[model samples]
Target chain A: MSDASELPVGIADVEAAAVRIRDQAVRTPLLGSAALDARAGGRVLLKAETLQRTGSFKFRGAYNLISALDPAERDRGVVAFSSGNHAQGVAHAASLLGWASTVVMPADAPPLKIERTRAFGATVVTYDRATESREEIAAALAARTGAVTVPPYDHSMIMAGQGTVGLELAAQAAERELVPDQVLVPCGGGGLTAGIATALADRLPRAVVRPVEPAGYDDTTRSLAAGERVANAAGASSICDALLAPTPGELTFAVNAALAGPGLVVDDDQVRAAVRWAFEELKLAVEPGGAVALAAVLAGVADTADRVSVVVLSGGNTDARWLT
Target chain B: MSDASELPVGIADVEAAAVRIRDQAVRTPLLGSAALDARAGGRVLLKAETLQRTGSFKFRGAYNLISALDPAERDRGVVAFSSGNHAQGVAHAASLLGWASTVVMPADAPPLKIERTRAFGATVVTYDRATESREEIAAALAARTGAVTVPPYDHSMIMAGQGTVGLELAAQAAERELVPDQVLVPCGGGGLTAGIATALADRLPRAVVRPVEPAGYDDTTRSLAAGERVANAAGASSICDALLAPTPGELTFAVNAALAGPGLVVDDDQVRAAVRWAFEELKLAVEPGGAVALAAVLAGVADTADRVSVVVLSGGNTDARWLT
Candidate 1:
């Protein structure tokens, strides 16, 4: 049970999740990319989620959610709607719990993601992109199969799990000789951003939590300003496909809206340039979406003058076809 | 001063280096890439030196060597010869020590490397590749300027410093649930391999240490049987230019010869494929040299049958021009 008045995720939540998933997940290190740091005119530490299970932080939330299921819910299985990292996360989480998982992904999803979902023993339910709404299909599938719907980014367990990143980041930073002044986290549906924000609020209350999103899909930014949820009708016009979400989640928005200072938008060219920089300077294989926050720093969106700042590298599972 | 009995580096030498350089260089995490582990049919842990200072493991040796210098020698500064990561390592180390540094690099060295060394306030002396040898030029510069030459490898301090990688790997593996049965390290002048073997031997006494070398430059492999250092006549033939040393160091060879199980060689194609695999599957930007150990595993060079193994990702700095 989550406390109503508490920050979306507190140190307690992250601490609990850390202990629960300690053996299952990798404790990825926060690495300093010195070359990129110099180019940005400050210290840049990358919390490498690309090295996470299923190659993304999505696994953290998925594992945390699955692990929290009651015995009856576990018996009934779980379902989710995603065409990317979340699909793989749900599949992997289900496999770990020995529970059935049914993932609803659009027919147009990347072949690599589709193949990986199947490899993890999840039942893939594909729907025509033009005719069916993913949410509607997911609801139908859940109802028919008597499976519990695990809505990405809307649940307390998932948010608490993602908060483990912030918890680790705070602990990891304290271990350093010098602490950072700010932390840049890439925002999508707001799960990662909210998680980090909540953890930071409890641990490093003074450290600024800056959320970064692609230029066109600036719903989170606008929503925070209007004090209401704002959907992006323009959709994602940037090169970062992983950040193509139309709007922020209700629960995630509430968490980040109160904690996130502001959201910064970076151009597509900067995103591409940051991707190239990650490859050349940091030797990191980050997806365009994962590189957005770093891209902002490289493009001067944030406080490049800060002595020490961090950019959470959310994941690295990019499609091979994009490289060529 | 290095003990005479050690010749090159021993457990004691590495232990002292570890104590000296512990705060200077990062204790890079030994982590498992889940997809890579599944592919190998064994657990594959990556000691991410790409995440190290100067974007390679060379910082450990460079920092260790520089920090070991007495006040008198420290005033003389340091000189190094390299076209890649080592140049930046020396520059960064010197900068940390408040000493001037002079680096002799081939004119055709990667632009990024040259820029990085310069950014660290090192005086880079470029030499024509067809005319002067980098080593000869560096030696000449050191003699003229009274600067101490910090060879990329071969020196007892450097080897002992590099050996700290092995020490950290051993400690990290022991804390984890599954200890590695074998350790694969990329061998250039045998500094990293020797260091790792000495440290790994002390902890996992029964585990085998395999030094991975590019097929065209398998001097370490041949030297193991010849009972002497074997020099490559057709030097530096591979995309992995970082591992293109003409021969293993005499001191390092002695240490490695005592503990190394076997030397493994993989083709350029294997290294290239592994680089691509790191990018696509693991989402890591690995240079050809850093990918060689993974290449050996992918090409079935290692006995990874349910045994946990650790591969040293020695560096991530690559000539991005090659991608073009």
Candidate 2:
């Protein structure tokens, strides 16, 4: 295991990011439902990042990274590649900070997300998920426009910013006199999971942090098991478009590999059930990708009996019609 | 206007209710969205009571009233009549407090609500909405079973309990250094409306508290304008089944008549649009009844330009199929 000193993101960095994003991002509530607690057979606290600015926790990282840019870099703008949530987050954060942004998104990403990203005043470029590489398109655009390429994850600033969620979760849980035994977080490139694991290492050291992924896209799970990053096989797909990252980020995996618990995976059916449960019980509009952690909990992938578990609903950017 | 001393429910009662239900009820968050603010042309703070226990604000009043009952009354249990939200609220509250509950509900109430009410361990008795009197059925059940009758609204304790929403809203807004210029609440029997008006009257005296209702079943709106209680037409109907109170409650209307601003009304289409907007933008699963206040705001029924308005999403108990 890597020592704390070697970690790319630390508690102090997350605290600093909290201070920077305090005025801009939403301190979304840590919600509890008796119904959910009963179903999980444990004390369940939900970190509702679905209510955060731009409908996801991605805004925290986007804002923190962009805001830290030097004047010369800030004036040139930012570029990013994402399925949807990260795109909307970068677009909205850039718009708020008066920086131009360009986002490369998969053409098959949810229509609502594409519309919202554009609505946030960012230039959107679409590519086929099957054949084209969004990273290359974003890189080409950033080179041409002289904009800084803001990767969706992997950066120290982005990981630190997402760590604020862990900071808030621990504090909110403390207010209710709770010490979480486990925390389930949705994972794409593992930035949020790694960041949360790092933060909880200081706040609640004994708490187990688990990265939850959609079944076919469980690259993070396989990578963690293999003790190195691994890519998903070609043509594997799931309804959770936002969590289709081929592999975990290098910087993120370095932290998660040391601190996070065994990764968990849930299938599309489980994800759909979790989304419906959020709508019916929590009254939160959670997307399929965001509901994977919840899907894990509901599917009994974790031993929650008599324990306090915190589940993060990471984003809510989807077409309502898809739910029906 | 009636003096504070003459009111049946006051800020003190609401404060006491807040303390009584503090541990049991979910203190839902005051959420805001930049997208929503841009659309309203003002700062729009959403009081998300849809996240409240039992998925509505009704649980607050139900719990407060049942908890305040004497030992003998508690032993005998309680009976209530509701379209849906109130039934589930009273049932869950009673179940939590160890009191047996019997709820008389409209037969046409949403199937999900009926199922949830029963799931909460309440004895459910159905009455035809157009042909039978639920009040008489509940009164008779209470008389025969020696159970206390917990009216949906009319009682002072119930009003004060619902008023906790307003108390929390004002305090949350204050935390953000904002003083709401107006507050919009969905009105069924005026219990929640009067409760909030009373709370804000003390906390934010200058703020206008308006009750929003669906157009066809707008008894509260008509009653507020007519200077006397008025009932909707016998055949009047709307998709918002939870908000079809025939007329305002006696005690609730008395408080609302003195403290509330002009009532506002929105059509079913507007309410549907508001629900869709809430799902897409606010990431909240707001039911049609819960969306009326939002509908009024989105439809420009009130002047929101350059103002800070608080809109209460009162409940989220509806069939997902209806949303489609």
TM-score top scorer: 2
Interface RMSD of each: 3.1, 1.3
Candidate 2 lDDT at A111 equals 88
What's the TM-score of chain A alone for every prediction?
0.94, 0.98
lDDT of 1 at B163: 83
Model 2 segments beyond 4 Å from truth?
none
Q: lDDT for model 1, please.
A: 0.82
Worst 10 residues of 1 chain A by lDDT: A1-10
Q: Write the per-residue lDDT of candidate 1 for residues B1-324, one digit (tens) a residue.
A: 123365556678889999998767878888777678778898888898887888888988888888877866666889999877888999999898888899998898778779988987799999997778888898888888899999988888888888888888888887776678899999888888988887877777788899999988899988987877889876356888788888888878888888885899999989988887777777777788888999999999887879899999998877543332
Q: Give the Cα-based TM-score of candidate 2 against the true structure.
A: 0.98
lDDT of 2 at A110: 89
Instruction: Superpose all Cα atoms of candidate 2 onto the true structure and report the RMSD in Å to 1 decimal.
Output: 1.4
Q: Could you estimate the TM-score for every candidate?
A: 0.90, 0.98
